[model samples]
Target: MTTAAPDLAAETRDALDADVAALRRGATLWTRLSLDQRATLLESIHASTSAVMAEWADVAATSKGLPPGHPLRGEEWLTGPYMTLVSTEWLARTLRTLAGGGNPLDGVRMDETAAGRLRAHVFPGDLSDRLIVSGFTGEVWFDRDVTMARARAAAGLGQRTPDRSGGIGLVLGAGNITSIPVADVLYELFASNRVSLLKVNPTQDTLVPVFERALAPLIEMGLLRIVTGGGDVGAYLTRHDEIDHVHITGSAQTFDAIVWGVGEDGAARKASGRPLLTTPITAELGGVSPIIVVPGDWSEADLAFQAEHVATMRLQNSGHNCVAGQILILSEDWPQREAFMDHVRRAVAATPSREVWYPRAAKRLDALRDAHPEASWSDDGRRAVIPFDGGAADNLEVVEQFAPVLGVTALPGLGQDFLDTAIAYADERLTGTLGANILIDPVAQTRLGDGFERALERLRYGTIAVNAWTAVGFLTPALPWGAYPGGTLDDAPSGIGVVHNALLLDRIDRAVVRGPFRPFPRSLTALRPASRGAFSLLPKPPWFTTARTGASVSAGLTRYRAGGGLLRLIPTMLNAFRA
Candidate 1:
């Protein structure tokens, strides 16, 4: 006899229920497994992922409108496989420390500043970190209140407590970054000590197979299950009694909808202090991230170098990154302000535009332009430069355009005074406290002296990078990536909690990252040399909007991912040189 056709809603509910049950079953084994068992499984997972990175990246790239073997496609490799592998390696190191060292900081070195703040030097922690990205440095700045004793006691708080047989976590994956769900699943499993029922985002349904292949080891262990559906499945899983917790990476609005209800009902539920979903939730949400370029006696070269750097932030991935600089805080009083702006305009115009692959991106871009038509560069319609003159500052600062739109807001002042005003602007005006960057030339740094140090202290952000994009903070597995803590279910500006924290610190205030004032070869700052500087320092990155040789870059990156060490490095370098 043939079975009756399954009802769509009923089937979704039943399927999600089974997924939760499987996760619960998988978690039971996790609770009883020793630390050694967890470490060994992670090692196995590492091997599984490493084995299929090239194939996984190729498939993922193709899904994102980037053709296979295209140079720009390497962006997929870096964000997808490279980042996942790095996160896995970091967790493995932590597991070893937790199991073998007895102390989480056994092999790690941490120091306290005179101000009584604990600082853990994370970047360039080893030879590989030093070799791959030279001169890049970052540190975890523990909250000022966290005393040394607390820092030590809370290093591995998750481990300090006995397992309460934690249940399943429903991970609502992000549609943008393909690696987010993979990392989220692993983080839930190893970091938070929970089994995961990962619901793939509808936007990236094509990547489910790659995820399955990479996570086969975890899946077979019954510790993880990947599910796919639309809102019905997500809603069922979110409110299901079996799910002990929910973790999501999306907008703050989505977080509210899941926690409360939607529209006036959500507002009423939030006001009444009663949420539909009782399970605890942690999230990593987007923010209107700012980049404050401190005014200084910058040379023509400095202005050119920073212009390309800034453009790369806004144009990378068609400017879909949550960490991309949303507002450009420039100094009105600086003599080079106009000159620097010229370079910015030139750079943005010169950079090759990519297709708006994101859903509703075109509409969003149109809304931003409609909201403010006095744009400096909006002729292309896709990419724009919104100038925030004195009167229009409010609209520019508050609104976060997710598309390739740049908003420039000029503050009046110079030196520490300018930096102080910019800091205040970010703290009071900006909506979220996710990530912010300060691009201060060494000349400016030296001029400001102790004032520069003070400005760093006052910037209220989860991560404050000097002369670097905030994305570096997000990509660094050792660094905790999240908003500044202290967000409630009622109001989560940048969301709460952190991910990719290898050390497993119980508390973190922010991460301070510093990059070189100038990239490898000074002349290469403008991207295309205007008859000056060095000829070629290194190959152009695939994500650079100006990149013309994506196909070759893709091939070299594939070879590099396929255990092609120095042998592959030479060809990649040559390809970069050619680009």
Candidate 2:
């Protein structure tokens, strides 16, 4: 039996080695192809991806315990196939521009923030985007030094140089989301100009067949390879000689395990700043995301809508998302603080109970419950809300509870004062810097004016979603998603680098995504009368866990995006209206 084990290990090593070698060879061929050819390849991928959307979403939903009739099943379609399809189409458009010898961001609106940071308005690319998400907007904020000329020069694949050499890139996929791996692979191939070998997390390996079908164009060209295995296989590929660069979407511990050794050896290596692996790496590690609520004179409808919004931020995908809101920071002096808390509880209770599908979810929840014995929980124990005062809740502040758990804490002051303190606390206390959200009344924001933007500047996070969940930044392919810069190998908090940046901009500081403060009809009345353009036809987003018609709406939106044309949105709009 021992001999057989060695033989099997040897066989696995040989297969992985062969795959890496193939990617190396494909990388060279990939570089030799013209921009036009690459664009054509991406178009083929989009068509192929569309063909597998239904089956792909189904497999993902079933594996995550959201069956066909399940209320949260819409999450599967939106997060899985819909996101992948939309991103593919957008990327194809960018590639075509490069192929046509035109700058991808040629006509893109560029502006500067209060602190002189360059920002590129990426979303609402056309009428379709404006119609699809309505008032939703996305912007990519570049580093302070990245000027307009420099950004223009550096944007797009092979824009500065028509021809470029490429290498083999290994992507370590996240287990929680099916679209993450697919999107990572696409970013590597299209954005970085590298042939990729995707190592899928074993927990979601059931989607391997679907991935193989969707990405068949790249697979057949040897530009991409997908493999599924446990940590041993990941460790093997991370250290493999043929792999030139690596990208991962998982936890900090996993990143540490790869860069350093495990256990005492790993600790010693980390302390000494001597890493085991020398390969260049980029990561999107999970963090304890914060939701900072600024004091405001909110109407009854606004309170109820924002409450559901907070619930959606925390409970989406059953809180399996890395960008899920883990901490709720409220102003102690805010008159509506208690009222908002009550509304949040009711919204959470109204949402259906979802399975805790991720591994060790119960153990993590138990740990949080043990830390805060005063925490409140749902009947099924799948959800919990732990309340703490001031900054005494160190346990909740520092821990990245990757489950349906929320830690609510209040700080002193109101308005700008409260915003300043909340921003400072989140920056200093939160475990990671991946993403954060701020909910403020639109009118209150106008009153605060520059103070609000300054607060945004002060908050140290990669993505800041104002009145929207940070997942919006993730779902949008145009935004660069990762940690704030300056993370070293030894002291990396949320890992390093960004992915899914379709425009391929360099030196991105962060992404700021804004959504309407209210849903659809409510949004029209909720916004200031002067800013009518900020209203959207979008009702409650189909991905919301509480949406009654999520499944049908999400499926319809996918078909509409996958080339079903404007006619496809007819039924989709109908389903959305029902939602």
Output the number of the TM-score-best candidate: 2
Q: Which regions of candidate 1 deviate over 4 angstroms?
A: 1-8, 69-71, 160-164, 390-393, 523-544, 547-579
Model 2: lDDT to the true structure: 0.84
Residue-level lDDT tens digits of model 2 in 1-579: 111112237778888878878877787788778777777887887898899999998999899888678888878888888889878877878877877777878889999998889999998788777776777899999988999999888888543453565588899999998899989998877767778999999988899999999999999988888888888788888877778899999988888988997999999998898998888998888888999998989888888888888888888888888999989999889899999999988888788877988999889988877877888788388888889875454767776778998889999998889999999999988889999999887777887887889889988899999988889889888888899887777766887988888888888999999988778887776556645225768778776777888888888888888888787678788778777
Which candidate leads the pack in lDDT? 2
Q: Residues 187-299, candidate 1, lDDT per residue (tens digit)?
A: 77766778898999997888888888888889998888988888766776777777888999988888988889789988999999998768899998878888899887777
lDDT of 1 at 160: 50
Model 1 scores worst on lDDT over the 10 consecutive residues at 529-538
Q: What's the lDDT for all of these models?
A: 0.76, 0.84
